[model samples]
Target: MELTNYLGLAAILFAIGSATVLLRRNSIVVFMGIELMLNATNLVLVTFARMHGDITGQLLAFFVMVVAAAEVVVGLAIIITIFRARRSASVDDVNLLQS
Candidate 1:
């Protein structure tokens, strides 16, 4: 696929993910949205790597995948803890950290 097509798809996915993050109240939905955005970025990185016949993008994508994995693990743990503490998954209800 062409770079523009790859980038455009990435942009669209990023937008949808952003909208999900902004419009949703559930913590799990927000986490899914973040994953969606990361996957979209990963696709674009791989596409660019293929287009340029270089491994740099692939390496970056690999690292990104690792980070994303770690993020999900930690993020889910935090969310779960928060949910247990507050008994609500809605973002507005958990505001103990807010000043």
Candidate 2:
């Protein structure tokens, strides 16, 4: 398979992830969407790095993975906390504006 195939797949994944984030209301789904998007980005980065015969893109992907790990930790904690307080995972149900 050509390297372009990887890029195309990454684009499709990113689009789906974006749609999930935009169309879904469940906090967990949105978080998964975000993770999907991040993975797509990593795919693109790694593909480019392979095509270029350079380590830059792979290095960037590694950093991105580290950030993603941190995000998973923090994002899940927030989701759990919200679910506990609101008893619902819908984004609309979270009304922080209320006094």
Candidate 3:
């Protein structure tokens, strides 16, 4: 794939993720949006690595994916805990520390 095409797709994905984060009220959806943004960044990194014929960017993307997986696990766990406590996934309802 051309570097420009890859970057364009990354940009589109990032935009969609941003929209999801802004328009979705559910905590889980917002978390997924964050994941989407991460994936978009990884795509850009890998594409640039390919364009430059270098392995460093690809390696960095791999590490990023690994960290993203860990983040998803931890994020989902936290979301579940919050859902249990609030009985809803809406972000607007979360204000436990402020109370």
Model 3: lDDT of residue 3: 71
Task: Using TM-score, give the best candidate's number.
Answer: 2
User: Residues 1-99, candidate 1, lDDT per residue (tens digit)?
Assistant: 457898899989988999999999998998899999998999889888988999999999999999999999999999999888878989888777868
- Score residue 67 of candidate 2 by CA lDDT: 100
What tens digits encode model 3's per-residue C-alpha lDDT throughout 31-56? 98999999999999998899899999
Clashes of each: 0, 0, 0
Residue 28 of model 1 has an lDDT of: 95
Instruction: Say which candidate scores most in lDDT.
Output: 2
lDDT of 1 at 73: 93
- Best to worst by TM-score, what's the order? 2, 3, 1
> Which 10 consecutive residues of model 1 have the lowest summed lDDT?
90-99
TM-score of 2: 0.94
Regions of candidate 1 where Cα sits further than 4 Å from its true position: 1-3, 97-99
Instruction: Go through the candidates in order and give the C-alpha RMSD of each one to the true structure.
Output: 1.5, 1.5, 1.6
Question: On a 0 to 100 scale, what is the lDDT of residue 71 in model 2?
Answer: 98
- Return the candidate ranking by lDDT, descending: 2, 3, 1
lDDT of each: 0.90, 0.97, 0.92
In model 1, the Cα lDDT at residue 31 comes to 88
